[model samples]
Target chain A: MLGAFFTGSAIVERQRLGLAARATLLLLCSGLSLVDSLHQANGSLDVLGRLSVLVAIAILAVVAGAAWPQSVWVPVAEAASVAVLVMANAGPHQPLLPYLLAPALEAGLIAGVRGAVATAGAAAAMFLAASPFEIRKGQSLTYSSTASEWVLLALATGLLAAWARRLGVRTAGSNEAYPAAYRLMTQLRTVSRHLSGGLDALSLAHIVLQQLRDRTGFDRAAVFVPGPEGELVVLAGEGNVPDWDTSLASDGLMAEVWSQQRGAARQSGFSGTKGLVSMALPLTIGARTVGVVALERRFKWEMEDDIDSLTSILDEAALRIETALLFSEIRTIATAEERRRLAREIHDGIAQELAFLGYVLDDLAARSEQEDMQGELRDLRAQVTRVVGDLRLSIFELRSEVQGQTGLGAALSDYVRSIGAASAMTVHLVLDETPNRLPVEAEAELLRIAQESVTNARKHSGAQNLWVTCRINPPAARLTIEDDGTGLGTGRDDSYGIQIMRERADRLGATLSISTRPEGGTKVDVALQARPVEIASDQGAGRDQ
Target chain B: MTTVILVDDHELIRQGLRRAFERDADFEVVGEAGTATEALRLIGELQPGVAIVDIRLPDANGLDLVKRLRAGSEKMGIVVLTMYSGDEHLFGALEAGASAFVSKDAPAEDIVAAARHAAVSPRAFTASDLAEAMKRRLEPTGPRLSPREREVLAMLAQGLGVAAIAKQLFISESTTKTHISKIYEKLGATNRAQALMSALRLGLIRQDPSPDRP
Candidate 1:
């Protein structure tokens, strides 16, 4: 009865599971005890003993039945109820010595080996206490035989208890870990599906950030890519924190993780951060650290679980980013190759035929010495010249793909000189070539920007002289095209030239400024503050060989 | 008479070039081939004094054909005739040892003159228009000379003597002479007149708009 009271209190406090096993043991013991007392009442049993036994059984049943499962006191209550039933039925007719094993058996079933051993010891002590009364009736041999059976029962039940405990431990471990493993598998499938869809680099970064947020629910998440001269800059970020410093300093937390190429965590008060605990993970591709991922949130003990899984998820995400980058680069090369093919076709087909037509006309005009025929031939030749000019311009546009034999500076110099020959305007090109050229994509973008500016100046600005300048200073580069002609008027930015230039500049992470010069001209300038440094991978470079 | 073999993929273009050469009594059309292989065989068999080759042959690039023909015989005049007037093709033909270059769209007189020049001189004989294009290409769109060197070249074009230029620039005569020599080296000229002509062609110095004194 006392064990049942303690078990009920523990269940209410802890709210553990497994309530049914403990409740059944208490109920069976209490009901059997009640019947024993009732049967003994008609005999020479005193009224006070029978009433006390009945009361204890009722209380124990009520308490144990109301208890929750998996409590420390559950087996205690079950053992106590068994002791009461055995004691109440202690007589030769019912042979309560056989009932002495009940407490240990119930304890073994309910709480395993330890509870079974303790309950059996208590049952044995009670059997001894009631043995003298039974001995006076000359039942000592029956008592000794039943006491030996009780010890055997305890041993058998102890083995069953140990077997059950092992099964429970395995079940508990699977219950906790299986669902988490399944979730990680599902997340990996979603990432691979997105990768196969051929997402661009920026879109890929956004999707990875969204997935990280959904999986870990960190307060803030950001990806930092390596910039020129070992600098790290935020490529993408998501969270309550708005407008984070785009570039992380060399001494910052993310930089430390990036440099070491490992994961690290910080608890509050590191460089103005407060309340939130932050962890930085290095985003590695092959053996090199390409970037870093930083996440932060308000401190919590449960965040340790979040940290463990977030590292792996971000590692997978880094691989996706590299794949997306490579896909974009391949697409660029394919487009350039297609453009070169188109240019060659135009050069070899229509342009060649037209030049032959001019020769035939020249030969016919020379055969006829008539003055009127000479004038007609002159008119025809002028028309042919105009057509050839337009075709050459088309060829130039198509051949804008930067060939590997020349850098952007030499290509631009060649193009401007060709234009200068045909145009009344004198185009000047000034280039300060860097020791190492900008990346291929970046160089292509700058070339387009310069091309658009020059074409716009030729067609719309009516510029007599255009100056094109390109200068590179390590992590920064600037390109300027200024024409000495009519200034830019209001609402001129809506033109396709300006819109395309702005879009290309955005791709390069450059600032493009178009303004009318005070001396009467339009000047288009593009400045890139931080450029992506090309990592020199020996294996990648060796693939060509 | 200069013996000429016409090589063009288009039959009509070859007929037109043959007719253009017939008008001149000093020139004779010996043979014609429409493909690079046939042209090479005819050039080897007929051994014409000059060959007018179109840049876009049916089988190979005219520049490559020029390179091959020049390798076989240095005396045969190889005049590159092409529709494309770009400097890439022009310089490519000249660099490949062609004796002359003439665009297909140019006047028949220009080709005749190029052929005559090729047969007689056998030196690089760029057509007048092509020569002008080559000069324009040589004109540095970027600053090829230092500011001081440009100033010296401009003074030299203005008929200033070396001592007079030194006095005007407040520099020693030796420094002025050094600037002049650098300017000559960059302009690829040997004398004052050639240097002035190059400077004028490049727009580094404006042409004097007034009439010249005799």
Candidate 2:
């Protein structure tokens, strides 16, 4: 009974519960033990010894529980206290015998079924040991029955506690599931919204051109933005515009409007092309010329009202265009920064560690006197060397990018050459690129797709030869990677690599196809079509002015 | 003995390379620096016979450092040791006047040999894949400018305006402009000046009065 009181008080103290509950349970157990002891007391000294022992055990348990309630040692201390209590109250009809269930229950709650069994076993042993003394003192003749009953009760209570603990654990796991699912749903919604927005500069420029064409009935129109060298290069164009200079000089009509921040018209009736009128308007936002819009009409007509409406449309669209441009620039910089950081991390952390391991292996190889050991170490070192080479390749891939100065052709050539040097496969590269390059982001995506395809070929295809061909014309590009290797294997159709390549192609409105070649290996092809406006303009340019 | 200084951002790489050099009696480990600034300071103070430079540095590009070192002393052997084994980096190191280009994955013996070669001839560029790279460069794979495009590019270089070039070539202004755009496209240049510069670099046009003189 005292053991139960101590256990209840210890649990209550550990939980820092209401004092009333702790006092009521303590007093109830104490009163029951007192009434039972007083009923069967042979002498006052015996009653005093039992009551004092109960108080001592209770004090020890409370103090231990208060000090280390959550410690692993708490259950151990509780078991010890229960054993001590059993020894102190060594009688056939011990009033505190039921109290041994307390430690068993506590152990079960903390350490599960194994702890419950162990603690109950210890309590049973203490009961058995005390029963011998009780029989010798001739206090009772039915000690064995009482002992069995006590052991059964302690075990039953401990098992019950263990079952409750498992139930609590299951509830906790379910509690976290709802929040996790909610977070994923929210994130998916955000990503879907971003996909549908399509706020990139190229798409926005197309929208601006489409709106301009709709608002103004010009035969042909083109948007020109200042290039890296301050020359006006076409950003987007619509209608049959005769190929104006790929880039206009600073003194051209478009440049003049950009410099003056006003619209200007020019009539070019001289030279074979007659009855053609061109007007240029500066796309300004807050006194800053972001770009110039050049409109060409077949017949010389009154363009004054057309110019005013066009100016209003551009004035409204300028900020959006500028924002899109800035957004793309920032995105490119962030991507480059991220790539550099990843390269640095891989180089400094894993690559360095692997190299160091190689050196350590070298030292081990030198120290080994046995030929076989040295040979094994040599093989390990070779493996490490290969891994380091692969890491270096990864870092190089992460670092390589297509920039304005090096266009796609140069970058691709450099990359293909690197691949050839790194692998045993014979690489054949054919690059045909025009001076006009795609947008930086598009070029970057194409480069990555090519890299992925090549890397996949190098790793998986057991090919002896690889061929890469790239044809780039402004707004239109086709990249083909072919290898005389084992054809596309099963179960790789939806691989992450292919999925990522598809995603990249999808973002650029390009088509990606992976197929096994007729003769031998696999072929991965990606082709981006020119915008519809470009095609229309081409057809328009075919007609005489 | 060829005294060598190591410059790599990773200390462990430097240590490994240092140990590799230590095994070779022909080379001495004079100094080591983890950044470009420290490398310059160390090289200046030590004036090592050979400087093994890694292409990636914390403060500056390794190729730029090679250029600066070469400018400081043409006789000092400079070996570019890099993880990037691309032709671009190799050519960059070569153009920056490095005596030898060695990949980090190269064997210690190869690196030692490269250092020895650098010590012997600092002016002669050497790399394992130099011949292949040179062959690739020699291949007629670049965009071929047409005869008309070439003429138009030359006129562009001579500062002839579009109208003047058109009148002189007996072509319409739009036709001349179309030829100029095609030339720019073939040359991967954004403007006439850039086209002219690319033309000059590619030997399509000359610095003299007429491109036909070539």
Candidate 3:
């Protein structure tokens, strides 16, 4: 009807003008039909009238399609297509029909189950109103048949509505939770493992953000966390944060989601905002809330379903970040302990000797007379020997390869042989358990014990015979030293050197055992459990460092 | 002439002292032994007037050799030289029948002089020297406890598990436990070895009869 005015003004004037007017008329009619279908009326629509309605609907559809390129209508315009089909199926031939698929499809596409059901009811009523019971044309619409048709139509409609609604909900649910769902799949695929490996907070946070990005899509994603003042500041970001009065907007939209505590969004008329969108999650590691996360993305979509995925993703990511931070802190503490141990070793092994050397040199300088000078020279020579010993200990302490370079086996052998030559007693050493190398701490402890025992035997024990042995296994290593000597100053006075050895053994978590040799001698034993190669070596490196 | 056997692990110290001793007409080296075993064997063979021995020898320590010589040849006077002169060593050497426990730093002449004197009688060994040596051994040098204190300490040093010691003393376990606790307190010791070490240093324990269980 509206096309009559446009045609009078533009038909035959130009193809473009005529086409434009027709397009506008079709669009207007299609929209009008949709409104009619949606609104319920209880009055009389006769059979002829219903048939005309179908004709009009078909015309409206044709025109609407033609008008498509010229009109930037919303997706909601799809309802017009459903309405056109509904009328064509139930046209006034009064085919005595009671149901149609168009309404259900339209409902599934647009309003879903309830609306589709309602549309079916309306269509059924329209069918009854269009053609009343007339027996002459043999179209005798009995009350029972009419009631049955309405009943079947209602049931079919309700069922179709329900089915379409289920599909829509399932698809929507999967789509909205796609991020979390994907994240869950990934976590299942590659759950992390325990390690002594370490990392820093920033690096862990970086990993968290990276993982989260994989699970979701966002335009200008950013993480805002609480600052010192309790106001949220950007701790990390994925996208730009637009300055907007997003405070209450987020609170009102996202914080109110009931089931999951996830925020639901509407076409927010949140004024004074610049394309701002946000969702906040209470980040939890275990039961403690170290911080809260505020995420915002600038995009338009139904984001309500994403709530579940986002919350879970953020929560897991937060936990991992915390764990990584702890690992990093532990590494720092271990490094510090290593430094302290190194400091003590340096002081004890090298520094004290140098100081003693300094005193010896001073004494030498102060001496007078030929005989005194000769005696001083002897003292100087001993100090020099001590200085050399200190240097060896220092070098061994400083570098791992130094011991190997000097050849620990060779050094130990040479020490025993040399000491034997210097003293009356014979020193014998045996090394068994071949192939596998002992850990560095194991080696160091063994060396210290050997040195102390030798010194004590030479200085206190009038022992004539000495024997030392080393045994190694995968789990543990052992060293034993024995001497045929009077035991520890009549077996009563404490050996300070032995005490030091015991202290060191305790530090290594090794076992130390000593006993009087059955044949009037002394025997000292130290044993340590073997650890995994990597762990043992790494521990050695840690202590060495 | 005072005939003697020279026993030592260090040949230089032994030879050095020998040159000074042989110069005296009264002292003569009848035999030489490098270890406690050799010294004990030679003591059987030589029957010398005196035995000059280094306290710290290769084959055995000071007290062991002294005890061996005393047991086998009770009449032979013995003189011992050592780097260590703790009360435990002094009393231990004395208990082993060492006529005297001398220091390594002592002049060779002084050692020869002591050896020659020991051959005669205990009167030849200065009581003042013996007393001074014992005093040094019985007193604190560094952080070590006096000898007698170390003995009393050994009772405590046996450990918190000193149930037998407690039973022997007819004391309650708790009281026994308290004594052990006080021992730890005085020595700043946390365990058995520490207490034992403090007690040994203090010379509060008997160090003469036997050696420490290694």
Q: What does candidate 3's lDDT look like per residue over A1-545, in tens digits? A: 12343333222332243234334534554454445545535223443355355445435533553454222121123223323333343332223222233333333333445555555555545444534432224444454365446435544644664575466556544563566557744553343332212233444444555554455433433343333233333334443332211232134332233223443444431221346445555556555554444444444433466766767776776666555444444544564467557754654445434433433443344344577776766677556544544443333323222143332343455465446534567777775542223333335556667777776776678898899786653225677889999975653454677788887676445688888877887888887652222233223323422
- For candidate 3, give the lDDT of residue B77: 80
Q: DockQ (Cα-based) per candidate?
A: 0.10, 0.17, 0.01
- My TM-score estimates for the predictions, one after another, are 0.50, 0.59, 0.25
The lDDT of each candidate is 0.66, 0.73, 0.51
Per-residue lDDT over B79-190 for candidate 3, one digit per residue giving the tens place of the 0 to 100 score? 8765432334556767777776665444444666678667767323432256644544443333333232344355554443566654655543433444455467657889
Off by over 4 Å in 1: A1-199, A202-282, A285-317, A367-373, A403-405, A433-437, A459-462, A473-476, A485-521, A527-545, B10-19, B56-58, B83-88, B127-214
Q: Summarize candidate 1's per-residue lDDT along A433-474 as a digit string, tens digits.
A: 533345455667788788888877876777999999988533
Best by DockQ: 2
Over B70-112, each residue of candidate 2 has an lDDT whose tens digit, in order, gives 9999899999987765677889999999999987766565677
The alpha-carbon deviation from the true structure for residue A400 of candidate 1, after best TM-score superposition, in angstroms, is 4.2
> What's the TM-score of chain B for every model shown?
0.64, 0.71, 0.61
Highest TM-score among the candidates is held by which one? 2
* Top candidate by lDDT: 2
* Candidate 2: residue A309 Cα off by (Å): 1.9
User: A11-92, model 2: which lDDT tens digit per residue?
Assistant: 5643443123234444655666668766664755665676566556656665675676644355545555555564564455
